[model samples]
Target chain A: MSTASVPLPNWITYGLMPLLNLLVAFFISGLVVWWIGENPLEALRLLIEGSLGRGDAIGFTLFYTTSFIFTGLSVAVAFHAGLFNIGSEGQAYLGGLGAALVALALDQYVPWYVTMPFAVMGAALFGAGWALIPAWLQAKRGSHIVITTIMFNFIGAALMVYLLVNVLIVPGKMAPETRTFLPGGQLPKLDWLMAWFGLKLGPAPFNVSFLIALVMAFLVWVLIWRTKLGYEMRTLGISPSAAVYAGIPYARTVIIAMLISGGLAGMMALNPVMGASARLQVEFVGGAGFVGIAVSLMGRSHPLGIVLAALLFGILYQGGADLSFEMPNITREMIVVIQGLVILFAGALEYMFRPTMVHIYQRFKRA
Target chain B: MDFFDIVVSILGSTIRLSIPLLFTALAGLFTERAGVFDIGLEGKMLAAAFASACVAYLTGNAWLGLCGGIAVSIIFSLIHGFASITNRGNQIVSGVALNFVAAGLTVVLGQAWFGQGGRTPQVSGDGRFTPIILPFADAMREVPVIGPLYANVISGNNILTYLAFLAVPITWWVLFRTRFGLRLRAVGENPGAVDTAGISVTWLRYRAVIAAGFLCGFAGAYLSIAQSAAFIKDMSAGKGYIALAALIFAKWKPVPVMFACLLFGFLDAFANFMQGKAVPGIGEVPVQIFQALPYILTCILLAGFIGVARPPKAGGVAYTKER
Candidate 1:
């Protein structure tokens, strides 16, 4: 990639390269499955059936996809500003507080439609507030954002535990969780939408947040490509020196990009807190924040690519839960291994096969 | 318990707890000093913990388990090297990927082999690193003041604790006194200069990473075999990050690394000491405060509130001939 001796077409660079990387990742993941004495093909089959075979499976898949989209967009926005916002997990965690507060306050007074916007704002504001210190550290203080964000993740986890155990836990309840949200705070399931496709929706948590995710994805595209701040962010990401030469304010762009990224991450809470459980549970973010990095990288930081990648992961997640039989060896955690492999090949070793591809292309052209 | 007993117990546990941080922070010291920023310490430590515990259970030999741990950790290091050093890809991205892989694969494999809810079987007999009672421990126990301290706080620790304390001085000696240390630090600060002097920058960085892996093996092995009985799920539990925090809090110095780890370890011991108990003046202290203390302190340090902690000049950047 650094050499760039042979210029490749956009189709090969964007399309073929990522697909090749993804295949290698899956192949390695298959090897792990086989190592654990499970049939890779059987695992794959179960995965597909469990995620997409039935209406309920699809609904669950879409539910997971909704969270992934928000997190993916969060990571993508940060990526555009040359920031690795690993604190999305923490941001999303805090976002839960904002959302739970909104639901707890308004479930009795207002309808779902009226409360949804305020919930969104609350979540985003809290999430952005979490990102503020890390962003300031990176933008103004020259601290490494990666280290700070990872630290904040632990801090956030600890803070949440304290809040849940000491403050939010309902009296007479053993569990460290808030009271379940009422009907007005709950997100309505997309049963009608599924019916439009002739699929009968079951007890899956897939809901209106999926629609919000889609709209947000489109808005992210607009924010990255069509806005002045987005252009400045791109300039800053590509080359800091170039951005400085262009007189783009580094601190302002970094802070703004991170705030937007954090807000997007915060929005991820809606899918789980409001849509799924309708309550803020301990550790509910559930590593969706990390899955976003893989989604963003695999998607090449484009919203369109992120959607497809998010769906692929949603399949893996939903299907993995249903994997069992003679070999229950491929646990839900096997999906995490797959995610890591995807990050390894697609994110870190992205151009591992490029040199060979270029060599083959040159020989073919010469012939 | 009396005040003396409480203080003695806390100090003893502090020594017990800081051993892992000592090994891991030293591990990170070597790697970061060589100009590669390694966030995958958590992953390597974790994988090593699983591997060592598995082998320890199978062979019933703690030494063999230690070997297994080191070998597995080194494998991870080489993978990181290939990705970040050879391919010149993003080091942080490679590290993040490895962390995820370790977090996932260890549990997946552990469950497959043992079927104990993502944990290895509890190892006993010679499979464990038993605490060694010192020569004077019995004799000194009856003496006043220094007696209890000598008997408990300083003595009766496992081999890893002794080795961990010894490592600080050895690390300081190796880093400041040796020619290889000079070259390693020089490579980190200015790889081009080291290259100009006819040293292979790639080889130096690789050696540093391998050293890190070897030390992290001890850290991981200490967690599973020395400190506890078995490899539980997520047992490393951010010790690696706290070690990283210790590194930054120490400003990457070896002697201060020891003190920093002790400070963090004392926080841990104190938290456990005060759990479910309230102080006279203050209310029940949430254990989470201690859990988050290292990270919060590191963040403050990194933010230049305490001091400017400058990394190796070329840290996290791959060395390129063209550059």
Candidate 2:
């Protein structure tokens, strides 16, 4: 009667499960396309060509990838600490506000060089501050981080909406957004380098901001693998009691991990403000913080993995816009379907394979 | 309206609002009491709402729609249970994944079904549940205080509301009075000890989760077919999450959970009422204040010490029996 004696299907478990998940996602998306009376394969072809084929599309994909990189790192950091920080969206919003304020306040007084660092730091600090309340509750009071973080996301959104509507209203403007940044506070473009590298063949948003994201990704990789602090944080993630037994300060480590994650989420403002829009725009993060959960899961919580995942997501996002324009009936939100599917497959990978994958990996190491 | 009449009106809305949450929180209570973390309640409710709304729209049969909703919700619950219990995956991740899947797949299917991008057709009132007036309450309106409140708040609610309120007594009887309930509690609190004592831990947990699935389906039906006549994307809107918070804030007791749901329901109703009313100093109170009240209260309750509420020791751990 014991089902434990039954062997698992190797092909279905290890090889075919991921393909099946992708097939399911595509089939569901195809159904949406079919309802709109479009050939699914042709629609997918348009989607691919629109996302990665041309120069303008490539630039746009890179532009979107910048935000994903920061947010993916944010979620990955929290994941390593066994903390699901669903409030990253809220933290990013607060961070955008912080960056805007810093840009405005020091616009006339300081040069671009001084203001840029301070603006980024201000955003990170505000984001960390926003996340600290929920982290403290989880660490000190044993509250469920999932519910508290989600609640905080709503609170953050409300706070931002209230501010944009009332206190932070731009003079002589009716829109629920902040005013444009001063000239000196705006991030400078790498147009000179793009021209030098012959990248001026088409519309390009590639700038120094992308380089900063790459650097940050590398830095995160180093921090997670090469440092004692990273070791303790990862230890706490697996088992806080065991980490405490190993002489790590569980409370301090948890709070620090959450704070750093929020800081990275806040850093996502660099993309929309410093890179693309060059001003404080409303909804600049554009759900990337929430979407970062998918990226983190797909990336297996590694920095390099996240960067690749971000690139793939960026292509999908940029291409989705084109597909929507061409098809008119199918919207860009179909990309969300793909993202959700990726998260499901990655999260449930262990379930599909059971103990076989781990056993196989162990056997390979013995050689 | 007189002051008493205003209080009676507020109580009436509170009961209507609390009904869905009561079902969800009681559903959470069963799963958690049997050591299964029911974070997927939101996903279950959402999927059920979609199923019920779609079926009702197609067939114009409300009862069949309700059954379809429960069946679909039970299917999702089985998936969740299999992953978390049998495969020993992380319960939180599995729940979150379920939420994402429900949200994504519902929208995908909704667009396919209605061709209007993630919304079902407006359901006529005929396909929805109507309030059943209690007989002989026609003359109870004349009595002062408790009588007026009872007639106003308790007499005219939908059948689901009555059933939701009735679930508390049933849950208490099953948990404390019945042997099956005792076995469930034992499995949740200490699966190993229960296993040693010759009870099937898996069966008890499965029954508990199945019961939760049924209750949550009712909650979803109340949302789509009773409270509103149409289904919208992400209509659950974190209410299932708030129900989980209520379950924790009430310390997992069925009676306390009912009161907790009422407290949240009252806050939501009051918030809705306050949107247009211009307070003296506030000058048309900001909508954000009302929108954030329930979440703010949940955060405060969770962060502050309100009598130590401990989860079962084996709550999130999966049981694997040795052969």
Best by TM-score: 1
- Output candidate 2 Cα RMSD: 4.0
Candidate 1 regions exceeding 4 Å error are A1-3, A324-326
Worst 10 residues of 2 chain A by lDDT: A348-357
**lDDT tens digits, residues B1-323, model 1?**
89998899999999998988999999999989999989899999999999999999999999999999999999999989888888888888888899899999998999888888789999999999999999989999999999999999988999889999999999998899999999999988999999999999999999999999999999999999989989999899888889999999999899999999999999999999989999789989899998899899999999999979998899999888762
lDDT of 2 by residue, A158-241 (tens): 888888887877878888777677666676666675566555426656656677778889988888888998999899989988
List model 1 lDDT by residue over A36-61, tens digit each: 88889988988999999999999999
TM-score, cand. 2: 0.89
> What are the TM values for chain B, all candidates?
0.98, 0.93
- Give the DockQ of candidate 2: 0.40
